[model samples]
Target: MSDLYGRHKAVLPDWLALYYADPIEITHGEGRHVWDADGKRYLDFFGGILTTMTAHALPEITKAVSEQAGRIIHSSTLYLNRPMVEMAERIAELSGIPDARVFFTTSGTEANDTALLLATSYRRSNQILAMRNSYHGRSFSTVGITGNKGWSPTSLSPLQTLYVHGGVRTRGPYAELSDDEFIAACVDDLEDLLGHVRPPAALIAEPIQGVGGFTSPPDGLYAAFRRVLQERGILWIADEVQTGWGRTGEHFWGWQAHAENGPPDILTFAKGIGNGMSIGGVVARAEIMNCLDSNSISTFGGTQITMAAGLANLTYLLEHDLQGNARRVGGLLIERLRAVAAQLPGVREVRGRGLMIGIELVKPGTDTADPETAAAVLEAAREEGLLLGKGGGHNTSALRIAPPLSLTVAEAEEGAAILERALRSRVQ
Candidate 1:
């Protein structure tokens, strides 16, 4: 191992996951690519878990952060910050929640934490509902709501969390049903769970379960459940950390796929808004957001530099209509990958919307997850000068592809070809 790798292993937690056996230190990046410490160029398809929103080292984002840093970097939330207010205004308008109130945080975990605080306080209930095979964040509170066994490390939590079904469409009891039937069954399950437990403060879900290998229920599944939750005054918290800001191609927000009822009551977002800068936030109507009796402030939540980065990133994303680009390019990429998956027996499913996609790895003949080969594929792809990400329910066997929203059709084709080679070489 390299000296840096040795130091990392020595200092970092043992559970901190690294992609390849030999991790490459990324030195610099521009556009859709990044260069490792040894001066090797690679197509960064994962985009730092989809945080590098528009592109890596985009000039606009760089200029904004630089300009803001030169002026004022740190002004605590106690003081007024112009950039923070401006960015929050933009987000509130885009968030689709009526009379929305925006509160920024440093990461998705904090945003969800704040959301949970608001929900429980507003509803006067400590009981919470979370979708099965879903991942929200890593904090103590967020972990309690995370239903994925691989990600949730502890069962101890301050609040009582109940796991609900219908997050994954392919490998569950509802897998055999049609889309409409699947929605109905999931709604029935949610109703049954509600009847058994004390009324939950909220039902937290990701429109597309990100760390669960990009799996999602059929479209409109959440809408069906919304009606049931509405009657009981249980808030619907849409964890848009990975699925927000038009990454999903067809819709600006993943929840738009299920817009039959309306937008979610509370929405938590992060991981893409400020590109590489740390920025996460929660949006809710004025009433729910004002429910907190105690004063709450995020120390580094909406720093001027980060807000500048966010404003710049959002501007570039909207002005250039990168959302449209995601739709056109991601559609072609998924189709190409589906064709490739058809030829590979180890491939189980090619799924996702927009730039967010997942290729599930399985034993060639059996339906069992093949994490060993999946790791081999990740190693092979890195060796081929392409970086990818791995995620799934308990197995961690799915290849995640989420290039920047600005990914071109040519880049998509190139990444797909590299992925095809990686899969073929790894799977028997």
Candidate 2:
């Protein structure tokens, strides 16, 4: 038990396969760096899949959790709690949704499930529409809406969810369709799908597709889709699980990046909202949320400890202006990565804004990049004391870089250096 890896190997459940162990067991983390069991440190560029926005063990969040634990940790959602009310008020004020109401959960998947249920209840429709390459969650309903076929296998009855290609695939970041073309295709697809099935209860989408290879659709895509949904009287649900909480640079919420389009009727978030704490919430307009009165309620949705952590995390994000920092540092990293990509052979494109960036790697003979090369780069980076994540579909290959908002310029430069070395060694 003295050896970290041995201790874990002995006690870890056999049913769970390690996602990415790297032969290094993480013992502690601070800011943007984590120490392995062997006392080796690595710069964390993935940031817990964009979960630790404020950084590891943030002082303010720790204090709030500590204080709340000393008092009360759990309370049935049957009664309103002060921390829950305060967190809801903060969310409503910041979002500028005057009639905003919040429903709390412990994970992004649960929050999305709640949103889907709410959408179905309000619109009273069975069919749901989602974009291609989207990853909502692992739950049956959310997984059904997820566009990735690999994650969800073909079944006899797959929850009756409808799928459509968001836009035409282009030779750029996210498949691009001309604004007009995308709009026309979306409307036609929705019409065709609705003709076969009932009208959709809701149209769910991510402002920027995180698991969908960090794809960002062209400007006016959202606006055009909103118009179509409005014409059909369908609700719009924005899933900001990975892109919200100011991680996308300038905006506090990912949907804000498309404010010119129109705000979503229901917005869901998790990840950075608690700055690493386990908390997710759904923010809905009063009209949509009020429909919940006819449905069954849960007791542990909004516990006191989770609410406290969320409140403190939100306060810290606002007071310190971490959103601005994300924009600034993200710009710096994108520029650096772009420069490196220009010098590399297999590099295809560098996409994303703020801290949510992706490097698409293209192979020579293949139409798309080689996924193995992307894996090599990630492994090389880990060997060099840096960590990164990967994404994209079967023929696609990309390296996802989403570090903590607290990442410094020097650390960013160092990460770029390591990445350059890795790509250089692999390409030749």
Candidate 3:
């Protein structure tokens, strides 16, 4: 290990994972690429887990953050901050919840934590329904709701959590069922679970299971669950930390795919909105947001600097029609990857919507998850100057590919070619 790597290990928790066997210290980034401390350029396919939305070091975000820093970087939530108000207004409008109120936090974990607090308080219940193979956050409360064993470090939690099925369409027991049948089975399971337990405050789900390797159930599955939740006065919380802001391409919000019944009762978002600025928040109707009896404030949340970055980032994303770009470019990228997967014996599935995609790896001629091959592919890709991400609830055997929405056709093609070579090497 390099001296820096040794130092990192010494200071950082071992549980805080780093990518690649030999981790590269990223020195700078721009557009869809980053350079390591040793000045090796790499095509960044994962965008720091979808946190860098538009592009790396985009001038708009840099200028916004810099200008705001010159004036005032932080002012507690006690004061009226213009950038905060503006960003919240835009987010509230885009949120689709009636009378929506937005509360900013520093990260998605805190955002979901806030959402859970609101749901439980609003409904006067601490029970929650979470999808199996789902990952909400790292906090004590969120870990309880997380269904992925690898991510959920503890069973003890303040809320009562029941794991539901239907996150992964291919690997679950209901895999053989058709879409309609699958939805029906999951809905039935949800109903059965609900009948036995005290009414849950909300059903929290990722529109696309991010850390669960970008898995998703059939469209309208959540819509079906929404109907049942509505009957029981239980809220629906859409964890859009990785799928929000048109990253999924076809929809502005991941919840929109399951919007037949209506938008989610509560929506939590982080990661991409600030384009690498630390920003996260929860949006809900006024009544639910106002349910808290005591005054609560996020001291470092919605500070002037981050709010400015968020505003600039969001504006650039919309004005450039990056969502449509994600659709057009991401579609071509996935098709290219599907073709590449077809040639590799280890590739089990290449599935995703738009830029948010996952390529599952498995032992050839067998159904067993192949996390070793997955790691090999990651290292191989890095050697070829490409960066990718790995995730899976079962065994961390899926390679995640979520580049910046601003990724160009040429960049996408370049990254795909490198990844194809890596996967081929593993199979050989």
Best by lDDT: 3
Model 1, residue pairs in steric clash: none
Off by over 4 Å in 2: 1-21, 153-158, 167-197, 293-295
Q: What tens-digit string does per-residue lDDT give for candidate 1 at 118-174? A: 999999999999999999999999999998899989999998998888999988888
List the candidate 3 regions with Cα displacement exceeding 4 Å. Answer: none
| TM-score against truth, every candidate | 0.99, 0.91, 0.99
RMSD in angstroms, all models?
0.8, 2.8, 0.8
Model 1: runs farther than 4 Å from truth? Answer: none
Ranking by lDDT: 3, 1, 2
lDDT of 3 by residue, 121-219 (tens): 999999999999999999999999999999987889999999999899998889999999999999999999988998999999999999999999999
Q: Give the TM-score of candidate 3.
A: 0.99
Candidate 2 vs candidate 3, TM-score winner: 3
CA lDDT of each candidate?
A: 0.93, 0.79, 0.94
Against the correct fold, how does model 1 do in TM-score? 0.99
The clash number for model 3 is 0
Alpha carbon deviation, residue 125, candidate 2 (Å): 1.0
